[model samples]
Target: MKFTNGYWMNRPEYDVESPMETYDARQDEKKLIAFAPFKRVLTRGDQLNLGATTMTFTSPVENVIGVKLEHFDSENHGPSFKVNNLDPDVAIQIDDNTASLTSGQLKVSLPLRTDFDLKFTVDGKLITESAQKAQGVIFNHDTKVSYMREQLSMGIDEKIYGLGERFGNFVKNGQSIDIWNQDCGTGSEQAYKNIPFYISSNGYGVFVDEPQRVSFEVGSENVDRVQFSTEGQSLQYYVIYGPTPKEVLHRYTQLTGAINLPPAWSFGLWLSTSFTTDYSESTVLKFIDGMKEHHIPLDVFHFDCFWQKGFEWCTLAWDKEMFPDPVGLLEKIHNRGVKVCVWLNPYIAQKSSLFVEAKEKGYLIKRQNGDVWQWDLWQAGNGFVDFTNPDAVAWYQSKLKELLNMGVDCFKTDFGERIPVDDVKFFDGSNPKQEHNYYTLQYNKAVYEAIKDVKGSEEAVVFARSATVGSQSYPVHWGGDCLSNYNSMRDSLRGGLSFLLSGFGFWSHDIGGFEDGADRPTPDLYKRWTQFGLLSSHSRYHGSNVYRVPWNFDEEAVANTKRFVDLKLSLMPYLYTQAAHSAHYGNPLMRPMFLEFSEDPNVFDNSTQYMFGSQLLVAPIFNESGRGHYYLPGGKWTSLLDGKVYSVPLAGQWVDEEYDELSLPVLVRENTILIRNEKADHASYDYTKDVDIHLYQLSDGKVTTKVVDLHGDDVATVTAKRKASKISVNTTGISGSVNVYVHSDNNITSARLVDGVAEIDL
Candidate 1:
């Protein structure tokens, strides 16, 4: 992807062609087309042997401009990201020397005669521009491949974020990232979910609109520019503009796809039978009973790969030997008010009974010679399900319908990152290279739709692993395989933060880590990770060779698990409301610190901490020393635990403290109204009744908080305002008496709801 030896010259083998000037401009409908040649037209003879690059401009939504650069026009194969074009009104102006297209507050203009940079601006202020020698039509003789590329200017101290679920440093400034999906674990440069989109600190984001592999050099190849290239005849990208970081995400999600709200019960704690562990009906019964005995709330119980027999993974059948009566077992678990999730992947092994049927029906991918593509990677001679074929999708879904009938609630759609591309052919003739990353999208979509069809749309959810640009529509995705050490836990947080910034609504990870090998986590690691996992949007305890039940570690671990699980269940009234907000406006439930505190430079690179929902700040303890480090941006924060106060006077102050294993930083923001139900035993209940509305440092302005029911509908809206020493509270859609607590620097005061309103004087 990097073509430059230095700033002055290109690498010897690559023949690069860049536009010198835009010679002509033409308007076709709403699109403005510009012709820029590789060389300047000094004479009529100079235009004889040169090739020209065509740049087309259009607008899809307000404040978003789409630019398509083409070296040579060719037929575009099927299967691209589903871009929602709402057809917003745009302004097109043509002058003698320049051509500009404006959509809402964002405009893209290019020079007509003398070549100038293709500039993007918001309200006439430059955000980023494609300078000279920035757009490339390159041919690498060594690889015999053609690529279309564009390099946009990066501002000073501009921090880049959201190149998908990356595991390294939070700020993606100097990484050479490839938008290729891989099965590598969480501690590598390769990512399971690779999105061809990045948000810049300069109030704009660029999304490459290609399903094929798009390689990006974020100030790596050229220190001053961020370059993205694809192996094709054309490259298409869109520049989304926003004055704030959240607004940029709002617009990007609007353009790509809206986030689907997972079921409310999914926000509760999920306990899974560890992968590769020996688990039968007895083992499952013991784990579920243990949770009940220990008084730890559980919502979903998942069965990993061993649910099916070995080497027959996607058979979608319950191993008869392991569970002779899967239906009865599932019913028993459901009777306990718990849901069931089973693991599945798209690869159909030859040993599976469905293999012959799939091959005969053309449900599996085939090679160019028309033979079914088979490999011996994870399973012995497995073939990928060709999701491009509709019958194949139905065939796969039919197998899952059996599971649904057996009381399985959802599926952990895993292992789509290992799809093969070489010499393979899709049923619908989709480009092979393009199908590599996009295969996960279709794979997850098929499973999600089946679940939606069987269990009502309100109950559909999937814990997917691999993802592409628009995979945010699939509700919940987890951080892939990770080690059991503290460093792996730290990097997993980084990866999840980056994934949330990529326009996802909810995310989760294994509690004690996935690839824990033989020696599982230490007792301290298990307890520490329990606190972090329970605080996430979706919580799951899963691992590889060892069980993840807290009692397996120690009694302290059991207590830690119960404590946080109880806290999370009590906070569902607040969490589900914020979750509904994310579904409505495409904001992530788990947010990177910079997304909330964009004005504070100290939070721009802090991945050790994050904002859970919209009100709480969580800083996970990563080291074994029990020392916690976090920053609060220019506000007064109150601990939801133990009634402690944190008044940070400095603009960016980091608080370092030591604590027992029971707690870490879980701070409530100032001027916020948080609703909680302390007596609620589960995640799904009537959120409107018997709830405590805690007003933390209520500012002078009116702040309204809305609560949603288990079905994700508005049940109540509580508004409070304070001026000086008096605070007035008003409520709508509330009938029963409510308790109100006022949290301040000195102490906490309590009051009761009188006639659906409350007045408190300090």
Candidate 2:
């Protein structure tokens, strides 16, 4: 992906052709087209010998400009991300000298009589530009293949964020990232989810419109620009204008797809049967019983890969030897008010009874020779299902439907990253290189649709592993395959925050890590990770070769997990509202500090802590020493756990807070009202009953917060307006009694509300 040996010259066996000057320009009703020669046309003879690159610019929606640079005119490949809701009407003005296309406040200008340049602006102020050899048609001398690349200018001190769930550093500057989906685990630079999108600190976003492997060099190849390239005859990208990072994500997800609100029960604790661990029905029962005995609030229970017999993964049948009556066992779990999620992948082993049926029906991916592709990596003689084929997708979905008929609530769709590309063929005749990354999108979609068909649309959810661009439409994805250590815990947070910037709303990771290096996670690590995991949008306790039952570690671990689980259940009224916001807009449940505090430079690289929802700041304790350093942007932060007040400075100051294993640093922002369900034992409850609305430093202003029900409908709206020492409270569509508490100077002023309105004097 890197083309330059230095700034002076291209690497060996590389030939680059850059646009030099615009020769001609034209405009249609909706778009402007310009032709630019690779070099300056010195004579008429030069025009006859060289071909010109065509550049087309249009507006898909207000404030977004789509640019396509092409070397050869060809029909577009199919399976683009769905953007059916975009506006098509845009205004353009053209003359002999220049062409200007305007979309709302954002405008793109191209000079016709001068050098080849495209400048973007908002309200006549320049944001970014592609000029002076910034757009190039590159060729590899050894392979005789060409690529289209674009380099957009980056301003001084402009930083980059989001490349999809990368476990590296949070800021993407100086990073060479590839949008290739892989199963390289969480320890390396390789990512399971690689989205071809990035938002810059200067308040503009660039999204490469390619399903294939797009390569990006963020301020690496050229320190002054962010260069991205895709191997093809044309490159298509969109420039989205947002003066703020949050608005950027909102528009980005609007162009791609927004996250769906998951079911409310999913917010509670999920206990999984660890991969490669021995878990029969009795073992599952024992774990469930232990959780009840320890008073840990449990919701969903997941059965991992070993649920199917060995070498027969994705058979959709429980191993009878282990689970004698799978339906009965699931019914027992369901009888105890727990949901069941079974693990599945797209791969079908030869030993599976359905493999022959899939091969005969052409439900599997085939090689160029018209034979089913077979490999022996995870399963013996396995073949991947081709979701591109409608029948193949239906066949796979039918198998999952049977499980749902037998009381399965959801599925953990795993291992879509290990797809075959060499000598492979899709039923739709898609480009294999592009399908390598896009396969997960189709794979997860098929399963998600099947669940929606069986369960209602409001109840559909999947715990997916691998993803590419636009896969944020899936409800929840986890940090894949991490070690049970403090470093892995830290890196997982980094990856989740990075993913949040990429538009994924709900994310989770293994509570005590998926796999420990040589042994299981220590009791200290489990206790610490428990606090972090329970705070995630989706919480799950899982591991490999070891049980993740809280009591397995120690009694203290059990108590610690129970405490956090209860706390999370108590906060469901607030958390679920945040989840609904993520589904409606694109704000993530877990947000990097920079997204909220973009003006503070200290938060640009701070990945150790994040904003949980819009009100609370959570700094997870990563080390065993129980010491965490975090920065609080200028505000009056009140500790959510203890009523400790800390006034953060305007310049942003770091605080090193020490705590015992029972708690970490969680602070509530000032001038905010947090709604909590004080009487809920489970996540799915009447959010308006006995609801406690805690007013935190409610400065003289009107603050309104709504509580959404399980179906993402507004059940209640609490409006608080402060005038001097008196605060007026009003509620609409709310039932049951409400308690209003005012937190100031470690004193609580309580008021009981019976009807529509009340007033409290502070």
Candidate 3:
């Protein structure tokens, strides 16, 4: 996608034409359009042959600007992204030489009569801009049509992040990233989910609103610019402005879509049959029985690919060889208070009976020559289901409807990536190149809609493996296959964080890694990963050839797994409420440190550390020694392991005490009101009764309030305020023991606190 040999020379076959000056500006209602000529027009004769690009600038919603630059305006690509039309909230003022528009806190000013430049200023200071040869149209003779692209300016020290579940480096500064979804595992540069959005450290973000393939060069092709191009004549992108990182996400989610909150039990521990591992009703029963015997909490059980026979993937039939009695097995598994998730893929193998039916009915993707498209990549004669066809979607869902009728609670929708790219045609006549990456969105949408129909809106879920721009609307997604090692574990975390920044609410990874064969993850790695995994939005045990049962590693792995699962169950009141918040608002369940502590510079690029909810901080051990160094933002953090307090002031660092395989680092920030369920036995326990709100390091003069779900009706709000000599407690829908822990510069002589009420004296 890189078209430049250097600054002065273009690639051999591509011709680049950049806008030189603004010829005329037009305004209609609230929309502003700037006509820019590719060549300099100083005279009337210069305007005669104005065969140049036209850049149209408008505001879709407040604080979000959409820029569409078109070389040829005749192409009409249907099935655009679902952008809701909201009334614009910006005021526009245009004059002869200068034009300025304001939306929320974002102001865009253009020097109309001068050089064509775009200045995006938030809070009256320029964060970045599109200057010089930034906006353009490129023509490649090797392709059928010309393309348009936009290159926005970047700061010298700015670090780019996001672009959807990237497994590459955490910072995407000098990388050539294509927003094309592929079924690559966690160890490769290819990503399962490739969103055309990136946020920089300089406080602004650009989201290419196309569901199709959008290529981005983040300071790679051009060191000082972030260039993005599409394969067609028109390129449309949105610049979302945020005064802070959280606000940026707020704006971005408002534009794309917000995620629905997954079910409460879905947040707990999920056990899976390792990929390609032989398992039947007896094997699954033994694993469940063994976990119960070891006191490990397991909420959901998943069946990987081998659940169906090898050549009949989309048959949705239980392999008679392995699971002959799927109905009875499902009933038995559900009888043990566990949910069931079966794996599924979009590809229908030629051997599958459904494939022949689909081919006869024209329900499969076709080539340019109007033949069914087939590939031999993961499976022989694999034909992709054409999600663009409504009848095809219904046919695919009918297959799933049969499984759902047999008590399959959820689905791990895998491999929507690796879609056919060349000479292929969608039923709706969507551009094949555009459909290459956007197909996953349609695939997930169909599956999600089917589950929503069967399980009701709030109960449906998918452990999806691939995604695109608006795929966050689906509930749960997991990190793709990864090797079972410490480095892979770190990369998994980085990938999840990247996805989180891209507006995904829930995500998980295979617990001790996926592809470890001979040199498997040690018991140390299992225990360490168990702690981190259990703290995730969803926890699952999956591997390629090996079993991920805790006992397979060691006794310590079993014990540690039990400990963390129990801890998560104990903290259900906190985690469930956070999950609800994620569903209602688009904030992620697991957040990077910078999302919570945006004002602190130390939290940037701190992938080794993350916030479990709003209060708990977890820093997993990257090495086998279990020694982890992390930054705690200026507070007195109390260890959740032993209740030991450590002071961190003046933006410095802290090292956790030697955390062996049995334990990892967990800290609660100061002034946090930790909410937990009173009972930790059941995943679906009533969170309202006898809940404990443990107050940590209560700083004087600040009001601390926390919210927790009271039954399914109302959320209990608890507020506590501490003054010089007394602390006042108030509650809205809660009646429980509020344990107020006094810490740091407090002179309380006597503490006589009672359940549901408290009074402290100095």
Candidate 4:
């Protein structure tokens, strides 16, 4: 993807043509067009053999401008992303030297003369511009291939983030990234989900509209420019403007799609059968009973790949040898208030009984020679299901419907990253390169729809692995395979935070890691990871070749796991509200510290600590000694574990705190109200009953907070105001009884019950 040898020269066998000047500028009702030639015209005779590139600028919606540069025009490739744009009317003004197009608060100016330069502004303030050699059409003369690339100027203090769930450094400066989905583990630069979208700290975002491979060089290929390119004759990108980073994400998600709200029960702890480990109905029951005996809360139990017989993955039939009575086992688990999730992939092996039928019905991906594509990787002679065909999607959904009829609650849709690209054909004739990353979107959608059809819309969820740009429409996705170590654990957090910035709302990772059974995770690592996992939006304990049962490590691990699980259940009232916000708006549950503290430069590269919700900040312990270094932005923060108070300075300071294995650093922001349910023993409970509202450092202002029930409906609203020594509380839309507590420095100074309205003395 890199074509330059240095700043002064290009690599061999490459010819890069940049727009030297704009020869002509014209305006229509909706767009502005400019013709830029690679070489400048000295006279009218010089235009005889010269070719020019057409540059078009238009606004798709308010505050969003789309730039398309083309050398050759062709029909748009099929299977484009589903984008709904609110195109408002725009006015184009042309003069002798400048041509300006204004839409809403955004204005784009282009030079009417020969010089090709573009300047973008919002509300009369400069945002960014494309100038100099920012736009180019490169040709590889050796292979006779060409590409189009565009670079946007970055501000001097700007930092770029969010290029999908990246495991590298948090700041993307000086990094070369490729948006190609792969099966690499969480420890590498390769990512399972590659989204061609990035937001800058300077309050603007850029999105490449290509579903195929898009390469980005963030201040690497060129120091002051963020370059993105695709292998085609045309390139299209959108510049979305926002005054803040949070607003940028809102606009970006509005352009794509927002995350769907997951069911309340899906927020609790999920225990999975370790991959490649031996597990039967008895083993699963023992694990469930062990959780109960240890006083650990359990919600969903997932059966990994071995649920189906070997070499017959995705058969949709239980392996009778391991699970003799699958129906009876599911009934028993359901009676214990647990939901069941089975693992499935889109690949069907030749040994599967349905393979012959799939091949006959053209439900599998085929080669150009009219034979079903076959390979031997995870399974023997596996063929991928073609989701492009409507019939194929129906056939696959029907298989999952049978499992639903037998009492399956959800599915873990995995392994969409290993799709074959070359010599294969889709049923709808989609480009193979684009389908490689987009296949997961269709695959997860089919399964998710099937679940919604069986279990209503509000109860549908899926644990997906691979994703592309629009795959955020799926409810929950987890970090893919990782090794059992401290480094892997830290990388997993980095990946998750990066994913949240890319517009994914819910994500999880293996509690004790997923690989390296010979050298299992240490007891300290398990205890530390347990704390972080249980606090995630969706928690799951899973591993490979080794059981993830808490007791398998040590008794202290069991106690630590139970403690955190209970703490999470206690915070359900607050967590579920945050989840609903993520679904309704585009805010993320797990946010990087900079998202909340945008003015503090210290948090720009800080990935170790994150804002759990709007009110709480969590710094996870990574080392064995339980010592962590985190920065607190200037605020009056109070510790949630103990009633300890810390007043941070205006410049923001770092604190290195030592914690026991039982706890980490969780701090509540000042002047915030957090709602909790103390009487709930499970994740899916009546959040309206016996609610406790904890008021933190009410500094003479009015603060209002609302709580939602199991169906995500508003059940209660509490408004509290402080006027010197007295706090007035009022409630409306109350579903059940509520109690209020006033805390100054994490101590409840006064308590009262809500009887229409109440007042407490501080």
lDDT by candidate, in order shown: 0.91, 0.88, 0.81, 0.87
Cα miss at 340, model 4 (Å)?
0.7
Question: What's the count of clashing pairs in each model shown?
Answer: 0, 0, 1, 1
Best-matching candidate per TM-score? 1
Residues 537-628 of candidate 2 have per-residue lDDT tens digits of 99999998888997777888988998899889999989998889767988898889999988888889989999999898999999899997
Off by over 4 Å in 2: none
Candidate 3 local Cα displacement, residue 729, angstroms: 2.9
* Clash total of candidate 2: 0
**Residue-wise C-alpha lDDT for candidate 4, range 1-762, written one tens digit per residue:** 778889978899888988877777798769998888877787888788776679888887677787889987877656687776777788788888888888777788887556678888987788888886788899999999888989899889889999999999999999999999999999888999999999899888888888888999999998888999998888888888876778878878888888888999999999999899899999999988888888888999999999999999878899999999999999999988889999999999999998998999999999999899999998888999999999999999999999998999999999899888899999999989888888989999999999999999988999999998878888799999988898899999999998889878889999989995575888899899999998888899999888899888899999899888888888988899888876677878888998888878889999988998888999989999889888999889988888688888888789998999998988899998887776666899877567777889889889998888878777778888999999998877654567777778646865656574778897
Q: Superposing all C-alpha atoms, what RMSD in Å does each candidate have to the true structure?
A: 1.0, 1.3, 2.3, 1.5
* lDDT of each residue in 68-135, candidate 1, tens digit only: 99989898886889999989999898899889999999999998768647999877788999988899
Model 2's lDDT to the true fold?
0.88
Query: What's each prediction's TM-score?
Result: 0.99, 0.98, 0.96, 0.98
Superposed model 1: Cα runs more than 4 Å off: none
Model 4 weakest 10-residue run by lDDT: 749-758
Q: How does residue 193 of candidate 4 score in lDDT?
A: 91
Task: List pairs with backbone clashes in candidate 4.
Answer: 22-114
